[model samples]
Target: MDLLIAWLLTAISLLIIAQLPIGVEIDNFGKALVAAIVFGILNAIVKPVLLVLTIPITILTLGIFLIILNAIIFGLAAALVQGFRLRYGFWSAIFGSVFLSIVNGLLNQVVSR
Candidate 1:
């Protein structure tokens, strides 16, 4: 149940991010959940691989390159979810990714209390 709420909050955050002046829209909550699941799975599975591959770049950029990697992962998750539609451009996805991450972090912190 806690996980469900977290995913719902993530979906809501994603929706808001999409609705921002520079945002996009997720058409269905169910699909958004699926997107979140995909994101988690990918983050656990592929993220480390990507991180390893980008080690030099990440080191060179002083870890700032992780932001771009995160955006790419978020975009991939959005693409995997059919109902979580993102008509916005790359910039919106980047911003939306940041928006949702921050919102999720805040919510997690509060909910864990």
Candidate 2:
């Protein structure tokens, strides 16, 4: 149940992110949901390895480099998911990931209460 709720919230966040001017585009709700699932899977499977590999940079940047890692994963997700596009390259991915994280955090807070 918790996982389902989280996934739905992520999908909602993706939909909201798509509406932003940052050039993250989702063709429809179905695409947003699919992108959310792919994004979650990528984060779960790939982000840890990336974090480990980028530890030096992450430390040097005082953890700020994690945002860039997140952007990379976001771009990968957009590449893998059909009908979802990061139209502005790395910059789009960066902004999209940041906004997505923010929106997801806010939604999670509301849902948790």
Candidate 3:
């Protein structure tokens, strides 16, 4: 199914991101899969509410605050997963989220076609 494919792709993207020097680390594919699920859940549930609450700051910052919000969610996901970690704290989360987005976009494009 499409949802299964997307989940696997997200896990793969997490693994790819871990291989980079961006301070995101995943112990194995299993952990990557778990992290991906948690990340997806948090994005789906928490992100929208946070976005609404931070509208003023987001507007003031020209939408740049979304990056910080994404990093916070990324860090939260890492916190909830045993084998997934963001080294260097918030800085790592910021880079990890950015790279994750990039890698996911690339992987989805390949998988979709």
For model 3, how big is the CA root-mean-square deviation? Answer: 0.7
Task: Put down candidate 2 lDDT per residue, 1-113, tens digits, no spaces.
Answer: 99889899999999999899999999999988899899999999999999999999999999999999999999999999999998899999999999999999999999999
Q: Model 3, 16-99: lDDT tens per residue?
A: 999999899999999999998998999999999999999999999999999999999999999999999888899999999999
**lDDT, candidates in the order shown:** 0.78, 0.95, 0.94
Worst 10 residues of 1 by lDDT: 15-24
The alpha-carbon deviation from the true structure for residue 107 of candidate 2, after best TM-score superposition, in angstroms, is 0.8
lDDT (tens digit, per residue) of candidate 1 on 1-113: 98788777776667656667765677766766777788788788989999999999999999999889888888788777777655676776788778888878887788788
Q: Considering lDDT, where higher is better, how would the candidates rank from best to worst? A: 2, 3, 1
Q: State every prediction's TM-score relative to the real structure.
A: 0.85, 0.97, 0.97
* lDDT over C-alpha atoms for residue 85 of model 2: 93
Q: Which ten residues in a row have the lowest lDDT in candidate 3?
A: 1-10
Candidate that beats the other on TM-score, 1 or 2, i.e. the better one: 2
Q: How much does each candidate deviate from the true structure in C-alpha RMSD?
A: 1.9, 0.7, 0.7
lDDT: the better of candidates 1 and 3:
3
TM-score for candidate 1: 0.85
How much is 76 displaced in model 2, in angstroms? 0.5
